[model samples]
Target: MKTARIIDILPQCYSLFLPPFFKNPIPIESAATCRNCAMLEKPDSHVHAPKFFSAKTKCCTHHPDIPNYLVGALMNSDDPEHETGRQRMLNRIAGKTSISPLGVFRPKKFTLLSRNSNLEYFGRSEFLRCPFHDDEGFCTVMPYWDAVCSTWFCKHDAGEEGWRFWRTLRTYLENLQKILSRYVLLKMDFKPSISGLSIDVSAPLTLQELDDLPPPEPIYRKSWGAWAGNETEFYKQAYTLIRQLSQDEFARIEGIEQKLLLRELEQAYGLLTTTPLPERLKKNPELNIEKISESSYLLSGYSPFDPLKISKRLYDCLDFFDGSLTNQQVIRLCHDQHEVGLPEEILKKLHRFRILIAVGETK
Candidate 1:
């Protein structure tokens, strides 16, 4: 037999001993923003937190909810930690907890899933405030928020890092759902393939269906204590597994982040001419633009896109906008006054970075 080289042996062993993937390099921002937002001053204004909705910041357009399996997990009280989570969730459901009136859960209006039912119970209410929101503008049960609420992000807040983080989290949640659902079915001696986890509570499977086609005695214990133990163990394993899964997924996608961000920049560049330039566009009064170099300029309070590089023509074009001129007018003036073919591409980038805003209609 021919002697094998080390290079040939390395590939096979790499898969066998792959390290547990940990640490999300992406920094996720979790602070609520409704209290200090300028938009909240408008009577019709709605809070935007990208995706996650809690007591402090709420997305009125898309009211989010807890998933069934996670609810089941919360019902467990096997350990002190689990019991605390369970009681907090119950308090929210009962409207006993102090919560804000920003999302969709209202005190006295929120209803819980029947304890005797299978994994079909969920909350529903007519109000825009979440039930767990307190009078002080905070979520009473933020620590135990549902998976969706925990992972949502606003596009502005997320940028490329946030997007990648959410994608990985979404994958983790899907896998977790499968694992927990199967665990529930297996405890009752049912085949895992026969049941599917419902994302919608309005159309949940009846307790009879959860018992399977023949309707047998419940395989999973129904008592709060018994359910608590099962769910607590499941949550522990789910969290550990998701961390590894998210890491693995991130490793695979890490190489493409820069490329994707560049593509987004490119697309934004293309929209410059088509989208009407904000008629009232002007430099943020609080921010002063300073020249860093012949080609680079810096603006205070600007993030993600700051200290931008600019050509003399582009700088002149920005000066022309002045809240009095439209983008087209600026382009025309640059050519007439300076004989420069000012590129609209640079303006588009500035607009996207909040360097420009439509404060009012231009005269």
Candidate 2:
């Protein structure tokens, strides 16, 4: 039997050496692996950065699985020289061996209480050191941690900016993982869990064998009240953190996020406006429009997540259309008054549901 040797003392000394930006020091009693000194530190200007190793950091000891999306991203990194790093991550996930060259502190195998009520167990091999952690107790990769790893911060619920910033990005990271999960599920025939793939850990299963297993049944979704509720909220925190950090790396993330939002909005607009006016024009008979609040109206038609706020605009474009005007005419009317493309966004949204349809098709 193995024991979890969580290093408590080193973190106190480690916290002292961290840069000034890390204002919140996790209390020793509460800090987990994510808040451990190794996860918190970055390489200093004076000290040589240590090489990557498999030694167990304080986090691996307690957690169940390292997210596959994080593993996949690292493997598929733009850095072509990351082949060795990729193989190491694969080996760690596969439970191939216990001993590593770095003398990583290995932790006892632990079970995760999965949302699906399945006994999801990580292989005994994984609770060793994180591949990104170096000998000097610093994380080599900081910004790109997947949803679970990013929120490993012990002070997340403490209402601090740094912790909240990571929470804001969690959904975005999870969405990326969902895309990868779809690809793997279709191609590899493996089932996905809320945390990761559901796999048996009694014996190490080869990638090929794991692929042969049947899919797991879906489970109920867990919800939370987060500061960043959607894309709009996500960008709010992203900008706030960028200003606070003043780090150039965060600027790149912000740029990418901006492009993604623009692309999604553009896609939504194009999808609605491209249809011919005479082909399908009618309010969706099935659309259940419910006035949720004085300011917000919930229309049951299309929601990428939930019922979209149709009344956020000054004028409800959907209410204006009565199948008498063409899509182009309605767009012209709204744009002529607003003089900005903002009205066009509203028009596109109205066209999204059968609120202002293309005419020939009956809803």
Candidate 3:
């Protein structure tokens, strides 16, 4: 009922009603309003452009009227009628003074969620903003945003050091952001096959064993990618307590991730930005990050995170070598998976591509 900000999660090429790879021929207006919904102004933007009205917009497809989502994602719990039942931010936040030693050894409880609970939340599958945020000013969960939320604040608020309890929050967030930034922006190639259409990759995880990776305490887990399918893959889907990336942080993280990927392989150990990249690259047999960087900009580059250049180098390397390895194969080899075996999730990807030439899968 409150005016909340929301974005439309429209599929890029494929639509159930439209043809595959069919783009929106109509241009979006200055307000970023879809042309499909140009006529209708009231609550129902549908009566105007009925043709492209998608269920996702929660109204007409052509005339999309998405409510702006100002807050972060959340999961609702039943009202806290009992004294003990309550919801806390579920992340392993690094600061605070609320809990004592005895509290550490205890379990926290939350109640069942209903359509209308005290808490307003989104789907648990992927990360999103909490629905309880009042569009006008403050967040409903401010007092109880929990440890992680309490700790993180950005350079935007230059003078205000968040919480004062943890000055190191920014550093930790930066490190985690570096790792998250890489995978979070990785665009997946979404090919539509009828087989996986109705399958639910985001199942409500239930566990019989309490200790065996039980469901994340509702508000605790970072969520992202509630927007699925083809186009959404190209965007940042990873949900975290603090979502925005400072310009410097984004650049720094990219560089670090590139270094990390290159360093994981034994061949790229001596790579230095100063060393002649070509000379250094020629010596290393595989996954030479130095070579990739040198060749791309003639050894005149500085950022550790260059996916385009790296992917190009990977392709070029794959082309030159007469060996039987594919691009994905080189990636797997770079990961040092032989010692620890391929992870099940990665194994699924390999199987999908039919690139599992190496034997051995865990049962």
Counted clashes in each candidate structure: 17, 14, 29
Residue 321, model 1: lDDT of 62
Q: Which 10 consecutive residues of model 2 have the lowest summed lDDT? A: 219-228
For all predicted structures, in order, the TM-scores are 0.37, 0.28, 0.18
Report how far off residue 111 is in candidate 3 (Å).
23
Q: Which sequence of candidate numbers ranks them by TM-score, best first?
A: 1, 2, 3
Q: Candidate 1's residue-wise lDDT over 164-212, tens digit each?
A: 4444544454344344334444443443223222223456555544432
Evaluate candidate 2 by giving its C-alpha RMSD to the native, one decimal: 21.4
Global lDDT of model 2 = 0.37
Instruction: Kindly list the per-residue Cα lDDT of model 3 for residues 108-210, writing each as its tens digit.
Output: 1111222234322221211122322322322334322322333332111111111121234223333333343333334222232311122232344244112
lDDT for 8 in candidate 1 is 28
Query: lDDT of candidate 3 vs native?
Result: 0.25
Clashes of 3: 29
lDDT of 3 at 360: 28
lDDT on C-alpha atoms for all candidate structures: 0.40, 0.37, 0.25
